[model samples]
Target: MKITGDQQLIKKMNKTIVLDTIRQRQPLSRADISAAIGLNKATVSSLVSELIDSHLVTEMGPGESSGGRKPTLLHFNRSAGYAVGIDIRVNDLLAVLVDLEGHVLQEKTVPLADFTPEHVLEQIRKTIRQFSKKLPESPYGIVGIGIGVPGLVDDKSRVVSAPNLDWNQVDLYESLASEFGPNLHIDNEANAGAIGEKLYGAGREAQNLIYLSIGIGIGSGIIVGGELYRGTSNFSGEVGHMTVAENGPLCRCGNRGCWETLASEKALLDRAAKLWSDSHLDLEEIIQLARGGEPRAVQLLDEIGARLGVGLANLVNILNPELIVIGNRLSLAGDLLQDAMLRTIENRSLSYHRKKSGVAFANLGIRSTALGAASMPITMFLSEPDPALAQEGSPSAGL
Candidate 1:
């Protein structure tokens, strides 16, 4: 078959253009939208009407006109629907309910003593039930749920492998689909963290970014051209497992001298135990000690920061992202390690590549993964074609 006019695709694309314009420049008039998107007044008006009918956009009273009549202004209805985001870790779960505009309406952090699929699923269901009861009436209620897991997650939302949790090929979507409907989605925690930063944190202004989640085990989220880059099989950003030393400590991923084994929070804690001779100190205490100018703690941070830089040099040499966000629990170390990290990156990576990449700490803190999960539904909802407009011969037919 040969391609033709395909009016539906054109309309869909135009709809996105109009919707995006309205979202960016709220209280815009039809004329303003027309000028912004280079679409005619009639086309803009038609799309606006459709959006209004769909409860996505609203008409405000009026705005000052160029000369003649006052123009009615348009606004994106952020409360048109709600989305749920869940970030699952080995010992904790963070769940958030967000409106269409990515504002957290309600959130909860629950401690988890169990990692069994049944236990985790039950907790998720209960949390969703609790959150759903509090949601305000809207055109779409709980539109979708997104989960960020700290391990290998497939395109279909299955937990392919989470060695930390000892999970293997757990079909998370299948387990929850019957109770939650088909809106549930899942991704690797680092990928979700990257999304969270892209949407709400330090990476907001960056088109190309790398989110280094320096947690118990290290992981990464790669963003390219403002989109999450999940390479074939969704295993693109496992930079933590990248070898940094020819012969060093073994990593849980069955690798020797992996970056995470030297620079991750787990590695820091383990090393701290040997030097400090205090086995009971948590990461926070160590970070606090470092903040207060403890010599050993400070030295530990320098070592970890240097290791972080070594891995980052490799990333800089390869991707040269505009921004590299250091995130996750280890981010709490703050300036204790940042200077050393930057210095190492400066010394290691090639001059030109190093110049192109800027490093920053994640501003969203622990909320990154959960918030990123919530953002998925909003992005999907905006880009998805309306079912009512899904004609048999449409480009998005049966989708």
Candidate 2:
């Protein structure tokens, strides 16, 4: 009995070291892991044996021989576990499956109807079930679910306020938990976007970053010191409502002439539709017209970019981040929009901030929010767990 207990302890410790090794450094050889993790070669040999047996790690083909024989490289099996992420938007709900390394495996988009609270919730449930059906066989299938709602979200994932969705006091976490089990997290869309950029997108190495999401409306996610700064009420990055114009048009969030009222894509489209009221022309057509050097479309997009830059300048003044990631539908215009924004920012922002802050378009486009939502489960799981990870090598935490 004593021997068996000691063997068990050794086995668990070895596995922990191996797991830590594999997670921190990918595609390493057993010899490399043993050397890097400071575990005895023999101990690593035994633990890797067990990890391979459990399908957690696998040896790829082979690597070049160093001083000794060529050894097989080990990698975390991409299919070890899967996570589901949901992003709720006005037009659609996006669902995705992600692996441990935040690689999206499969994704689906479901068109939304009226977007009433109950209707949206029902759609979320149906789509989540649908997305989960695509997962491969795994011991810890669907580790958790993360929802990115386009609004102010409390730490609890509650919809503190989302005027676009007309949502308030909506317990997104509770509702999701009731249907999908307790491992559910909710966050505002912009926060999720920032997290996405940090983990899997352009802002991966940026400590102080701002993710400006220009979707139907404008919102931002601020990451300071490598963590999201959601403020006291979890409403820190709602830059859209900042009053650029005291006498601006009415905003849905009950603020008059907010920044978004003048510069958001929705606002621009509303203005464009009225100013150029040719029944045959549509929004995309207008964008195409500008892309083809049409005078009005080009002028309109430029003005929109300028207005957006004004908003960005204020944010740069307050938060001098290392990077500002511009993403969402409008970013699709590429330099056409960015040039105007840059020009305005140069004029409006202080020289120090203008020089320090670098602007990059969000390359992921519509997928930004969806990918952000999809990666949420993995982030939450890897970060602090609700009950804390079980003591080293305990079963209560992940295997």
Candidate 3:
């Protein structure tokens, strides 16, 4: 149980769950909501009434009757309040604004010449300020801001260890909260990618799913039974550090022979630099070259994909999730890489969980983690208890 210093926070949280559920899955009846959220009938009724009163949810026509009178369908007012997601990458920043139903309303990108936490924060703040100006009129204001970072995140929104950004123990939560005034949330990029995919990507239909973000560094975001599964200390998806090549290349995290050294985006780039270092090319360029019958680039990507599949094979054997989603820069490489990874994984997996699941590309592509950042603020923007839970903010509410 969590003892909060505030009581109003508890009430708002209760209604927030109902509102979020309606927004995520529309046209749900109160009965369906209660069943979906495991809340009792009376609580659902009160929360639904509160949402309708707030103009966040509205009752539609009747739904099919389940013995009793037909229940009224409920839906979120998509125009209620907006959420912004930000993706902080090594080369650029992707910012997207989504409405209540997780629809993208606006998107923008900014270039980054270098990777510095302080500089990125300024750029992020400016981008957020500019993006907020474009939102349509709303009553509740922008609910929150979610940030997808390329490093480890504590529950308090601090960047514990982002090897790519070289940020260690930086309190980004305080920095953003100080400027934005409490509407900031942060998570490892992989976790954000996982949530974006879970809520709106290929894994949306699966309860147990793994989202592998194979970018400059390899990381994973896990979802078990329809919610993010953060392990002790909230850094569950740091699988990139998992050892693959015991004596392989040294990693920025001071580890040797890590899976990241084999399968990370930088790993591919490191191999590519030997082939072409005259110009700084984006990930798309490599994919384009590999696509345009460039055998060397194609071969390089295939090998990288094979190694990534090898790394994931271990995870699949252990997690046995229903779906495996691949995201980030290399995902844009398409089937050329996917085929190699698939072949390798099928060969390595012990046949039982082999065909039990399928690999698919992220619908949101590289922007997924950033779009997930848009979802992050949902927690921060929402200060109240979730209506679906028996107790507000209890671990089970989203654990």
Candidate RMSDs in Å, in order, are 3.9, 4.9, 5.6
Q: Which tens-of-lDDT digit does each residue in 1-399 have in candidate 1?
A: 224458878888999999999998998899999999899999999999999998889998899978999999999999987888998887789999999888899999889999898898889888888888888988767777889999999877888998888899999887776666665679998999999999999999999999988888888999999999999888889998999998989988788999999999899989988997846677899888888999988899999999999999999999989999988888988678898999999999999998878999889888889889888867776775572332222211111
| lDDT tens readout by residue for model 2, 45-113 | 877887787666788878889877888888887676677777788788877778877677788888986
For candidate 3, give the lDDT of residue 232. 93
- The parts of candidate 1 lying over 4 Å away from their true place are 1-5, 387-399
What are the clash counts of all predictions, listed in order? Answer: 0, 1, 6
lDDT score of residue 102 within candidate 2: 69
Instruction: Give the top-scoring candidate (lDDT).
Output: 1
lDDT of each: 0.86, 0.77, 0.80
In order of lDDT, best first, we have 1, 3, 2
Clashing pairs in 1: none
For candidate 1, give the lDDT of residue 43. Answer: 95
Best by TM-score: 1
